[model samples]
Target: MLSPYKVVTIGDAMITMNPISTGPLRFVTHFERKVGGAELNFAIGCARLGLQSRWISLLGKDEFGRVIYNFTRGEGVDMTHVQFVEGYPTSLNFKEIQEDGSGKTFYYRYQSPISTFTTEMMKDEMLEGVALLHLTGVFLAIDPKNVELVQELIQIAKQKNIPISFDPNIRLKLWSIEEARKVYEMIFPDIDILLTGLDEFRLITGKDSEAELENFAAVYNIRDLVIKDGANGSKLYREGMWTRVSSFKVTPVDTVGAGDGFDAGYVYGWLHSYEPDKLLRFANGVGALVTTVSGDNEGLPYFEEVDAFINNELIIER
Candidate 1:
């Protein structure tokens, strides 16, 4: 049965041009066009798991924007709050993948349509039935104004008693570490769930030890602090206890979007009130599945797929 809970997120979606060859993008002639974004991928991940996922954002009234709109709508994500603006262009990025699935992204998102979005567009009705509001640093890094918008949204979510899940998803290309750290600290107190990468946590707090992590969670009063360590697994801190779960071993084709999938999985488990260990295992399975596929959200598994994969019942034919 599909969960009655609704997961909502706001951010920018882009037309991702992925290189066909596994090398420098300069030498690659053929490319495959697809849709990708941090928050958008999270919405898609939630939708794939049979959660009511809503995406709120602005896009250009261009072909790329239309493609993203149609693609996301097809993924079963609610697009009621997504809009298209004039003049500004839809964001875009080209990916360069190496043999080991590591890659780089070159962004061409100047004057992005999302830049036109204002906090005024955010209304109480938007959170009318939302069970969770997920935020990421990707959107907050796009424009200085977005920080205020996110703060406003956080306030609205808090007023409504909706839990907020945050992922730092830090991108150095978009903003500096100093700038990101400042904004993160300002908002960390309000966060109920913090899903962050191990490296990002270290960079943000200057702490690497598990004890420090627990102390950070306690200081911030965060209910759930989730550390996503790619390939190593995930760790969760809640109620003065820490639970660690191992990652599923998989040969990766693309590493992008795995964390977003993990966020969705963790949120899903949280809403269902899964035990800490089971929650981390479920989230780890989702993240591991994402790395096995090439596209951003294509590998985000359905609940049945995740159950099978976690239970060792899934059979992949080569």
Candidate 2:
């Protein structure tokens, strides 16, 4: 058996909705509820691939919230830091899936209980057994209190010599570009592994070329940097070496959660000490597979699925 590394994820968890069609003209819709958050998705993705993962967040005292808590716990995720809040509503996101698997997502999340998390709620030992602390920019974007609390969490991780990974999965609906720019500036120096999209790079550096993106990562001294270009593959910079990795050629059913799947796949590769190229391949394979289904996190391939997909045994179609 492989050794397990304790992975810690911090962010908001929500109820996700994805509609599926059953016919050409008339469609029957079915809903699958799961814990959905950028960081939480990454953690769940890691857990699905056999890592010992944990999640920390504030869940509302509601039926929907309890469902999320129970589901994740049942998946073998440690929920030691999850707090049940009495007066707040859990966040919710809805996706409308077309027959071809394309969709639009809407978020209903302001004033969520998770955004109310404060530094006081965290303890030093909350991170005791963590080997890696994973965070998403959405937490910082959601609230100032969460930003401060995340800063504290990062400090604790640093103090304990635990590496930190950041996915600046920026949501333009959450804040103004200027506000996000300032936050990124404040947090860049603290991030170890930085995962972002080409749009994020363009927005952050005002640069359109991969050369400029690589230069930007070098300027920040990030150990592992990935610039994701949707469906076009991703570029990675590590240990002063840069590599352009091609993505799997597949017709996407829905693009949502694909990047999160990529983030999860890359984290799994990092935790398991896979080679750089293999890591990129694994990440891209999972990302491609995710698009074959709907929802923010459904169809996230497990280790077995990933292995089969990468080996070309599992043929994906449009």
Judging by TM-score against the true structure, name the best candidate: 1
**lDDT of every predicted structure (CA atoms):** 0.93, 0.81
Tens-digit lDDT string for candidate 1 (1-318): 678999899999999998988988888999999999999999999999999999999999999999999999998999999999999899989988887867888999999999998889989988989999999999999999999999999999999999999999998899999999999999899999999988889998899798998889889999999999998999998998889999998888777899999999999999999999999999999998888887888899999999999999985432
| Residue 100 lDDT, candidate 1, scale 0-100 | 82
User: What stretches of model 1 exceed 4 Å from their correct place?
Assistant: 98-102
Predicted model with the maximum lDDT: 1
Residues forming the 10-long window of minimal summed lDDT in candidate 2: 19-28
Question: Which residue pairs show backbone clashes in model 2?
Answer: 101-253
In the range 118-237, model 2's lDDT, one tens digit per residue, is 778888888897788888888888886677888899899989999888888888888888888888887888888888888887887688676776677778778898877878888788
Question: How do all models score by TM-score?
Answer: 0.97, 0.90
Clashing pairs in 1: none
